[model samples]
Target: MTNMTFSEQIWYGLFKPSKYKELVESRKSRSVLYILVILLVLGLVTFVVPTAAIITGFGGMNKLFSETMAPVAYDGNQLTIEEPFRMNVADTVFILDSTYYTVPDKELERDGTYIAVGSKNVRMTTIIGGEKWMDNITPIEQVLAPGFSNDSLVDMVPAIYVSLFLCYLIMCLLYFVKYGFLALILSFIINSMNKQMEIGLSFGQVYMVCFYGMSLGMLLTNFNIAMGLISPMLVSTVTVFVSMNFITMAMVSMRKGNQV
Candidate 1:
């Protein structure tokens, strides 16, 4: 096999349909290097935008909590928090069963962590990290921001990085399996088309083509997601269509070359 750099390989994968012939020729000589690199790149590119948005939101919330979460008031088994209540990363809000102005028990229950008390669900619930944390509180409630402290916020920096990295790695493996399955289905179409044109690919060759095809589709789908042009529900179908289109274009190019 030739010592093709990743950049050169990417150029071929993205732009030059004819170059897939070389990929097919060298397919048997392949190692895990290409798969690992491509999967890593795909996972990172797909996740980076959403992850950045999440981090930016967390930073904004941290700043808001630091600035506004002061002047907490406590009454006998009841706490009255000021507006701008920070939900995630803090458990500073509380609900009292006796108070007429009850806390957001239902909303917090739906979106966060909360403890339901009794059959009526009327109880003091604390929200932490966007989850309902504790239900049925005592009267001596301290609305202190325990986990939302500056130090704790700082700790999340490395935690977020590690989590995202692990998630990306897992996603890469899932994508590998998912695309492999889709390629197996697509290979039948490829075989029939190639037979008509007197030029065809093995199932393995089609699988590799689908893999490369999916790389471009992933980039495109992530771009669309980042730009809000499409919802995540459309991701699978869009990716399949894009991969099929890439393979079709490559096949057409190859057929034209054979005729010439």
Candidate 2:
């Protein structure tokens, strides 16, 4: 229509070739305006929720849920208590029947460091068990980290979450720069085909897609499926992909005032 062949007029789009074909064949709106708006919004959605933010949010959510749905029971005065117990996240907890290694010198050093003269029933928890750790592990088989076994599991979650948060953020930043909007658009279309989203969205509509999209791809793969259970990053990435394309294409078609 613009003095160019159909193929020539159609070169590259945010959508992949397959997605572009589907988008072209379908009745939709296509608008090229608001590139900045799309970028800003999608950037926020995908980037704003850092892994730390996510963990914090999850912690807050856990707090709220615990407070709201805690068990109710009778108190000493026959009164009702909504919660029977309080939950706290800890890294590691050790309840050894007895000390395997004897404590020397009643005067404890300013630092908490204690010398391990010999083996003892010292229940310990570590973050990551390594080769050296295995040698002195109480459970032997339960050697968490040779050099990094968590002394307490309860105390480690937040720290672990923090480390994960940092990695998660780094990956997000790296991918955001590497992929940017185009990658987001293409990813959006693919996820749409997978039915990850009911409708497509625009990069502007769901900010932070670039950061989160890559974050998820890397995080989930590392975690296998444990993180996947409650990972919104993956879900957002998928929704961002499928929904954005439909949304962008729809917007474009609307601008043209014509049917594909």
Candidate 3:
């Protein structure tokens, strides 16, 4: 059995696929479990820096709402604002104009105004992967809670943060499921390949190989998310490519009886 620590194993896993033969031969399923747990923890920790940046940036949001936003009132029937509010960020626009109940499709497409609030109702457009979604309209009464007012806007920031934290947890759970499923599929493929080559790898051993091979991909995915550097689809595509490449290299090394 190899005397490598978990951290050393991870390093070798990324930079030295030939080392996988020795790692697999070690038969330390407990080490594999430790690696999986460490990966999950690292995934969650990746959000901390970005979350801190967002929290620090809330000062600007507070200023925007407190200073730029006019006092607004939403009665049971109609919504009223003293003045229109507009802000544009990159490809997205936010608008609060009480005159028009609905925005024209042509204008929305041209201006990329995904959110528009008016007197009677609020119209929202969602776009994903360059596809424009249908507009969702909600009556003003339904949009605003009974006690919602301009004065309470700042107070709601904490609740929004709480909701975001909850969303992060949900995302982590989904990622865990996705990672496990992908590893299982890869293990199956590797095991079948090994059978044809007479390498005689068990499912458990192949699974451990997949777990280690996918580490770099998981790190890249989390880094992309924290940086917001690419689209979600692009991130997923890159992750799969990187992971498969590493797995292939590791399996090849195993077949050749390579070691660190």
Whole-model lDDT per candidate = 0.57, 0.36, 0.69
Tell me each candidate's TM-score: 0.58, 0.23, 0.65
**Which TM-score value belongs to model 1?**
0.58
* Per-residue accuracy of model 2 over 55-82 as CA lDDT, tens digit each: 3654654443343333322222221223
Ranking by lDDT: 3, 1, 2
As for candidate 3, its clashing pairs are: none
Tens digit per residue, CA lDDT, model 1, 58-173: 57535533553443343334434444233332112223222333344454644433432221223456455566556664323333332323344444656656765776777789
Clash totals for all candidate models: 8, 61, 0
Prediction 1 global C-alpha lDDT: 0.57
Per-candidate alpha-carbon RMSD to the true structure: 8.2, 16.8, 5.2
Which runs of model 3 end up more than 4 angstroms from their true locations?
Answer: 2-6, 19-55, 58-64, 68-70, 80-118, 122-126, 131-136, 177-179, 221-242
User: Across residues 1-260, which tens digit of lDDT does each residue of candidate 3 receive?
Assistant: 55888777767766677777667767477555656564565546565455556445645556656766897777667767788876554334567777666554544655332778888878887665556765788887777876566767677767856865664565567666877788888888888877887777778878878877887778777777566788967987987887788778877767776653
Cα lDDT of model 3 overall? 0.69
Say which prediction, candidate 2 or candidate 3, comes out ahead on lDDT. Answer: 3
Provide the global lDDT of candidate 2 against the true structure. 0.36
**Model 2, runs deviating above 4 Å:** 1-158, 174-181, 184-248, 257-260
